[model samples]
Each structure stands twice: as structure tokens, then as C-alpha cells.
Target: MEDDALILDLQPLPDGIDERLAAQLTFIAEADRLKTVLRASPLAAADRRENDAEHSWHLALMVVLLAEYADAPIDVGHAVKLVVVHDLVEVYAGDSPVYDPQAVLDQQAREEAAADRLFSLLPADQAREIRELWDEFEAGATPEARFGKGIDRLQPMLLNWLAGGGTWSMPGATEARVRAREAGVVAASAALGDAAGLMVDEGVRRGWIRTSEG
Candidate 1:
């Protein structure tokens, strides 16, 4: 609530803001571009697609609320940081939905370049901190990172089910593919994973999600 001073769209910045703070402010302002990076997943309303900012915020919230269900003990704050920074690269690289077959092409190069450009807007130490968090999230090796990932995978699936199979109805988004994509998160958190599995099953029964057989 008190961080309004950091919001670039708002009038004049705080008095005595230093060069370091100025850079940080600039990065924050630029990161706001994420709001324009639309995702394949639509909102529960199905009226419009959600943006990267909405996805990141929702992903962080999901991690916080579902921390208790993680398969291993996790630092919730660490997980939140991971989710918040993970997608910031999309501001520059643009979003490529995972189910998109073309998404894999040069994604790492694009995102890495985006990260360098965006995070560099912040002071050195701060940039390193965020970049490290982003890398950890990408690695998905740490317990916290894995849990963060599980929630990331779960968020859109929940939205899809709520939006009457939003992206699940896409030609490439078959039941088998969706289930396999969701399985990674299920391995990370039993409770949330179980819920995801059930939702996929219901989606199939509702004819919202299709199978190869069909």
C-alpha cells in the first residue's frame, strides 16, 4: 500500500530519490509493461485473455495459499519471490504459451536477453538478486523452486477449468497432453496436484477437454 511512491504512472517521485533508486524505479516502471503481455489462458470470465502481470500475481498468491500442501517443507517467501520474478522476462521477450508447439524455439535466448535488458535497469546487487531468483525458478531444482513451479503449472489449469476449458479446448491441448503437463506440479505437491488431476478428469467428462481417441 505504501509503495505508491515507486509506481511510475503516479505523479512526481519521492524527494531525494538517488541514482540507485532512480534506476530501480525505472525498472519497476518498465516491468509494468508486463501488463500488456497477454497469455493464452483467458480469465475465468472468458471475456478476455489474462496478461503476464495477472498471471505472476495470481501465481504468487497461489504459492502463498497452497504452501501448506507442498510435498516438502518450503520457504514461502522464497517461493513467492520466485513466482514474482520468474515471468518478468516476458515484458521484453513476450509471452509464448507452453502448449504452443513453436514456444520451444530459441525461447531461452529470447528470455535471457530480456532478463539482461530488464533486470539491468535495477542496481547491480538488486539485479543479481532478481536474476538469481528467476534462474532458480527456471531450474526447478530446489524444493522451493519446485513448489513454486507446481503452483505456476496449476494456476492456468484452474483458470481453464473455471473458464469452461479456456485453452483446454485448443487443438493441441488434448487430455493426455494436459495431464502430462500437469503431472510435474502434482509430483511437487500432493494436495494441489490431486485437485488438478480431478479437474482434468471433470474437464474430459464435460466435453470441455478432448482426448486423442476422440
Candidate 2:
């Protein structure tokens, strides 16, 4: 956690800033803290966990590269925007691990409050636009949002595979839990879903993930 002194003693914005620009800059400065919000997923090549900013950036890139795999036609630009802004609320709510049953109990309420507080830092128009995107992504009601959700679930699985089962090796990580968590990936894109299944199967075969019977 950042010390209160460092967070409270922020430098003031320079003089003569236009109202709109000041709001925009203020939101941007607040976004900087997202980099400090660490997630449970670790780097593929290292022991350290990936931060929320890195996770969001990687999701945006995934949308760019895998947009073609979406089950239905989608606006790639909108999908990219969805991924980029999806986790901004984590700056306030903090990243909750998917495997942590207790942490997920009130996840929606916590994130919604964070979204309201963080996005409200921007101009009204900008805040509404961002909040809509965030909500859409959360709802997963549209083709683009479904695709975005697919990659969001898929990325950590891929990372755990590449990192030699970093999280999968933890106690209580069973094949059933992994499959249940990633069912959305399969629903959105069969190809990517197959790939994710292959990773999990390999993980189990190699003893990276434990089976229920084990």
C-alpha cells in the first residue's frame, strides 16, 4: 500500500488550466494509481504478480489481435475501448482473485461504487461515456462485450500455463473450477475456447493443475 503522505501530498495542477482540460488531466493523474493495483495473475517469466494496468493493456492488445475470432461481427474500436477501461475501477476496489470465494461475495457492489467515484472525476459527458462502456463490459450483453469478457478470462489461464501453472498449483484449484471459470471463453469463440482447454489439459497432464480424484 502507498503511504498516506505520498497519496495525500499530490502536486497541484499548474495555473491557467481550462476547466475541461483540468478535469481531463485530473482524471489522467488519478488513473496513474491503477499501476499500483496488483492482480493475482503473475508475469509469465517471473514470480511477481501482474498489476492492473498491465493486465488492462494486455487485454486491449488481445482484442486488437483476436477481434476476428468473435462469434458475431463487432466494432473492434468499441471492443478495444471496453478492454482498456474495464478495470479502471480496480484502482479503488482493488483486484480480487477469482479463486477467492470470500472476496467475490460483494464484488459487483464494490466495483460499481469504485466506478462511480473514479469516473466522476472526469467531465460529465466523459464520465457518462466511460461508465456506459464499463457497464456494458460488465453486463456482457453485446457481441463486443462478450468477446471482451472472453479474453479477460482467457488471458490469466494462458499466463498460468506459460508460467508453468503459477496459480493452478495452489491448493483447491481443480479441473472443474478452471473449466467453470472459463466457460464464457468457449461461449464467445470456439477456437480460443479450444485453445484454452488444451492449455488446461496439458497443465493437468503435467501435474501443473491437480485433478479432483488426485
Candidate 3:
């Protein structure tokens, strides 16, 4: 409880701040526009450009509505917090295509740096809490992370299927793309798999998606 004792125990960020890091604070405000500017994942509706903040709102809403489908019991409140803050980094890092191979490879570096910078803007304790939640979401280790990821995968799959396979019909969409985008959720929850399968089936039945050629 003493000041000197606290200083002895306290640690600094794993990666210290720099000029590039400092600019991230101003960019964090752009997260408020995500819903309006960024589209859902490419598997979903490509026509819409949902901004970053809106995407977070939708993810939090999904966490609330779909908590029962989680593979294990979860603190939905914690899951909501994770989802709400997960992409706030995008306010600085910018959204990348989920299926873009090169983009996917580069994503972690870009986002990790963004996370370090954006979360540091808050008061020390609050910054740590938000950064830790963001890390938990990224690690995908806990029940909450798995459940949060399940919804994350499910939403775009559902949206794409509903939108008549908006991006799925593009020339390069392969079974591999579908698998890559949706498989993590399948691994996380059976109910999510079932829901995603139903969406895919509906997309085909409605002539929105073509079955793969032999």
C-alpha cells in the first residue's frame, strides 16, 4: 500500500511508447465511425461500408443475444467488454480483409502495435484493464474468448449468406475461403456451426451461391 512499495512492484509496458505510438490516441476517435465506414467481413455484405464504432456495437449486441450458444459458460459482461473494445485498435490500424492472405499475415503486427498505443491513452489502471481484455480476446484461450470468437465468426457468415452470398460469389471464393473464415467458430461451438451451415444452405437454395464444381 505504500508509494515506494508500489513503485517497486509496478511494471512498464512490454513495448514502450514512441512517436508513432503517440499518434494513435488521435486515431482512436475514428473507431466511433467503424459501423458507418467499414463493411462487415468480406464473407458478409460487401456493399455496405460500416464504420469501426458500429462494428463494435454490433459485436457487443451479438454477445448479449448469443451468450447461451457459447461452448462453455461465460461471463457475458466480460465477453461484451472484450467485443466492444476488440477492434478499437482498428481506429488506428485500419480494417484488413479477412481472406486476404498477405493482409492476414501482416495483421497481428499492425494490430498489436495499434493496441499498445491506443489502450495507453486511458489512465494507467484503466489502460491496463482494457489492454488485458484486448489481449484476452486475441489469445482466444478462455471460455469467454472462444465464445466471443464464435459470435465474431457467426455474424459475418450470417450476413453474407443473407445478403445473397455477396462476396462469396466473387471469382476467387473457394471452399478454402469459407473454411478459413468460418472454421474457428465451428471449433468453438456446435450451435454456431449449425447456424452457419443453415445460412450457407439457404444461400445456395436461394440461388445466391453456386455449389462448387467437381
Candidate 4:
């Protein structure tokens, strides 16, 4: 009995748990569950439509390549991470049109609710980290957030241009409207503005956006 007790005591226990990692994994798993509803915007390429996930991925790519254009110096990694998580609320809020003043008005409320519900599902610490990042992006108060916003506006402008001004040709879309939508990039980074200018030029050349109607 004494020998048996000593042997049992000598056996090692499993390692202590990493609650942080567990929470992170939980969030990552649930992240795929987000749904992105379209707002009458068509895709640039295939007949198939773009979803929120695709949009997030595209923006992440842009974040990497466009870091040099940020209005202020920023952590490119954080900027990319911000973009990856930004529209994740859209998975819940659905894609509200930038041109729809009413929809835009309601977007903040919807997205905040979605963030609460979605982030709460993760482990507590991970939830806090992710939610903080999401909040920073919404606030647009930091350099990373600004750059993220820039990419966010730039992507759709490019997509619409490629789609032959799918939204631009819609009843109320005008150059002024498009510029307003694209101008958020300036707040985030000047490079984003440069990119938007290039996109606007392309839109004009492709006849997707009107040029001289000012």
C-alpha cells in the first residue's frame, strides 16, 4: 500500500490549461458562422455574389499591400487584423448601403449589438481582446483604425468600378456620393486617398463613374 501510494504520487499530471488560447480557438471556430447579407451590390467577376467573408479576406489582403499609404505611421499587422474583424459585424448587421442615409444611421446600433452577442461567445479574455480591436476600428480614433477604414471604402469603390458601376448607375448614385463614400480613406491614410483617386480615374475611363458632371 505504501509503495503503491508513492508510485501514484510520482506520476505527473497533465499541464495546466491555457484559457487564453482556448478562448481564441473558440472565437476562430465561431467566426465562420457570420453571414454577410448583400445590399443590392453585384460582384465584379462571377455571376455569383460576394459574401462578407470574401470581403473581409479581400480587405485583409489590401491591408497588407497598402500599408505604405497610411495617413500616419501604423502597425500594419494591427491594421490588417482590424480589417479582418471590421465588417465581421456585417455578418450580423448585414451590409448596409453607404449611400442610404437611413440605413447608415441604423448601422451603428445593429453592429454594436452584433458585436456584443458575437464576442460574448468566446472565452472571456479572448472576447475582450477581440472586442477591443473591433471597438477601436469603429471608433476610428487610432492610426490602425483609420487605415482600416481607408481600405474598407477603397475595396467597394474598386469592386463597383469593375462591375461597370453597378451601384453608381443606380438611381441616386452620383460622383459626389461616390467621393463622399471614398473619402473615409483620407481619415485613415493618405495613400488610401491616392488609391481612391486612381480608382475614380479608372471608373471614369471605364465609364462606370461620371467624370465631368460636377
Candidate 5:
């Protein structure tokens, strides 16, 4: 028989405590690196480049504020989630300027590998959820994904316009190319697309972006 006065030496932790907590904490810590991943787009009034984390935050806010502009009914919460997690892989894959032709060549493969490594840092369920969100945004199949993609394209274009054609000054940045790339914005939101078109025309007039024939 066991002694009534016997005391337990060490207490056992609750079930799944260490494994779950460790995975979550590790993922959170890894996500912090996104703050250092600088993008090609500059801040509206500032000279410094924007980081991926800041870009994601801005997109999340845009999702909330601009959901009404989406062409179809959408789940705003789901859209916000998609934008916030969409660029986490950029932390590992690094940013390629929108007009960089060489960089765009293998961009998908590079980002896919980055997504695998970054999302796998989380617990299995969480990893699967985030990877799926990232995939949806890439596919742009759903109304929400299309809206998210439009917002993503519009933000940098707006920033370039506001910065007085910051990156648009690149030689490859032609009015035709800009319009071609931003067609998705029109597909998702006509009003926003029209606004974007005006900005591009203004950039061309200002000689910030070159004319197609130039």
C-alpha cells in the first residue's frame, strides 16, 4: 500500500503543453524577421523603403477600409487574414521589385520554397491554414482572392505615384507595362482601377514613367 503522507517530487505539465507552445512561440519569433525584409516601395512621404511587415499591416487595414470596393460580396475577415499572411514568405524569399524582369522569372518557385519553410514553423494545423491562405491569394480564383490581389497591386502603384514616381522611374516602367500589370485592380474594383489609371497617366505626363514608344 502507498503511504498517505507521500509527496509528489515533480508536477507533470498539462497534455500537449510543451509541443504546442513551443511551436507557436517559435513561429512568432520567426515572424519577427519580416520586419527587416525591405520592399521596393517607399513610404508616402519618407525616403526609406517599406518593410514586408509594414506592407502586410497596411494591406490588412486596406482590407477593412476598402472591402466595399470589392466587386463581389466577401468575407472581410477572411480577406484580411489573406493579406496579412500573404507576404510572410517574402521574409525568406526576399523582395523583387515589381518591374524586375529577371527576378520575376523564377519568382514563383522561390516563393513556394520560402512558404514551405516559413509556414512549417507553426503547428501542423496552423501551418496548413496559413499555407492555404497564401495559396488562395496566389491563385486569385475566389472573389476575396481577386480583391486581395487588386489591393496588393494598387498599394504599391499608389505609393509610386505619391512618391512622385519613385520606382516608376526605372527604365522598364512604361505606361503600357504599368497598365498591363494593374489590370487586375480594374477587374476587382472599377472605381479604384480608374483612379489608378489616372495616376499612371499623370506619371507619364510628369515623365516619371516612360511612354510605351519611348
Candidate 6:
């Protein structure tokens, strides 16, 4: 996309503010946009869709409380950080529904562009740091990232169970399909995975989620 095509929020910087502070403040304000980006999953206890900001916040708290159950040792702090920024790009590119393959298509390219546009609101060094964190979360290569990824998947599955089959009750959400989608939850922590697996089984038994195709 062309630079001219990008509409920026240009407001007067506070007098005598340093370049770094100005840029950081701008990025902070821009992050507020995340509150408006709705996601596919509904809030577990609420009647409405969850936004990117709420999802990130939920994951951050989950990471702290559930860190102990991780398959391998992880830096809890780092894992929390990964979850917080993982969905920041959704502010620009919007949330992608995992069950909808079309939504996930070109996901990387779209998110990278959003990351560049959003993270660049910070100073150069901070931009690089924030972008690297976003990349690490996306890669899910490191222990922290993998654990974060696991928690990310677990949250939605739990929501579906809590919401009487929430998104999973929608078309195309078969038992086998959901299991495949949630493999990462188990990969992150066996205990949580086992618990979620049992819930999925119940969901299938209750006819809230479909079983394998005949």
C-alpha cells in the first residue's frame, strides 16, 4: 500500500515532548482502535462478541494463572507479553475466524502489513522490538510462544463449551474438526488439554457439536 494511501491520526504533539515520547504516545492511542475489532468467538459469560482488546486482555490473565500447567517450562512474563500483542494486528486487518479457511488465507501477509503500519507509530527501535515480539508470537517457535499459542486456542474452546457450543455449534464444526483445531491446547499443557478433550466429548454427546462425517 502506498504511504499516501495510509490515513494517519495526526494531532499536535505536546510542547517539548521528545521524539521517542511523541511516537510512543501515538502508538498507544492507535492501540485503542483494537477495542473496536470484533472477533468470531463470543465472550464466555457475556451475550456479545469479544473484541481483540478483550481477547488479548483475557489471554494475558490466563497466561498468568495457567502458566504452571505448561508442557514445558516457560518464562511466564514473556508468554504474557506474547498473548497481549498477538492480536494487535487485528485492529487493522480484523479478526480471522479459524473455522473459515478463507479468513485465514493470506493471514500472514495481511498481519505483517498491519504490524508495520501500527508498530511503526513508535520510534524506530521500539518499532523493531514490538514487531519482533509480534513475529515471535506468530511463529510459535519458542517455548513461550508455543505456550502462549496453546492458551490462545484453549480460551475459545472453553468459550464454546461455556456458551452451550458457542461458535462450534455453527455449521462445519464437527467433532473431529474441532479436535484437530484444538490440538495446540493439548500441546501447551496436557492437563488443560485433557480437560478440554473431555468437554468436547460431552459437547458431541449432547449434540452441541457434530461428530465425524459419515
Expressed as tens digits, the lDDT of each residue in 52-134 for candidate 2 is 99999999999999988888888999999999999999888888888777878899999999898889989999999999999
Tens digits of lDDT, candidate 1, 1-214: 2422334646656778898988888888888889989999999864999999999999988888899999999999999999999999988788987767788687999999988888887999999999999999999999999998888889999899889889887777888889997897787998888999999989989998887744
Candidate 2 residue-wise lDDT at 142 = 96
lDDT of 5: 0.84
- Candidate 5 displacement at residue 202 in angstroms: 1.3
State residue 78's C-alpha deviation in candidate 6, in Å. 0.6
Off by over 4 Å in 3: 1-30, 33-37, 40-47, 170-172, 204-214
Tens-place lDDT digits, model 6, residues 1-214: 3432332335566689887887788788778879989888989767999988988998999999998899899999989889998889887888888877788898888988899888888889988888888999989899899989998998888888888888886666778789986788888889989988888889888988887654
Q: Is candidate 2 or candidate 4 better by TM-score?
A: 2
The numbered model that scores best in TM-score is 2
lDDT of each: 0.87, 0.87, 0.70, 0.74, 0.84, 0.84
* Model 2 root-mean-square deviation: 2.2
Clashing pairs in 4: 71-189, 146-188
Instruction: Please give the range of 10 consecutive residues that has the lowest summed lDDT in model 2.
Output: 1-10
Error of 5 at 135 (Å): 0.6
Off by over 4 Å in 4: 1-26, 201-207, 210-214
- Quote the positional error of residue 151 for candidate 6 in Å: 0.3
Clashing pairs in 2: none
Which pairs of residues clash in candidate 5, taking residues 3 or more apart in a chain or in different chains? none
lDDT of 2: 0.87
For residues 14-123, what per-residue lDDT tens digits would candidate 3 score against the true structure?
A: 45567455334334443443444465344233455456676677779988988887778999999999888888777557787664556567788989988886676566
How far off is residue 56 in model 2, in Å?
0.7
RMSD of each: 4.8, 2.2, 9.6, 10.6, 9.5, 2.5
Candidate 1: stretches off by over 4 Å: 1-16
Residues 1-214, model 5: lDDT tens digits: 1321111212333467688886777677667778989988889967798999999999989889999988899999999999998998877788877777887788899999989888887899999999999999999999999999999989999889889987787767778789886797998898889888888888889888887744
Which structure is stronger by lDDT: 2 or 4? 2
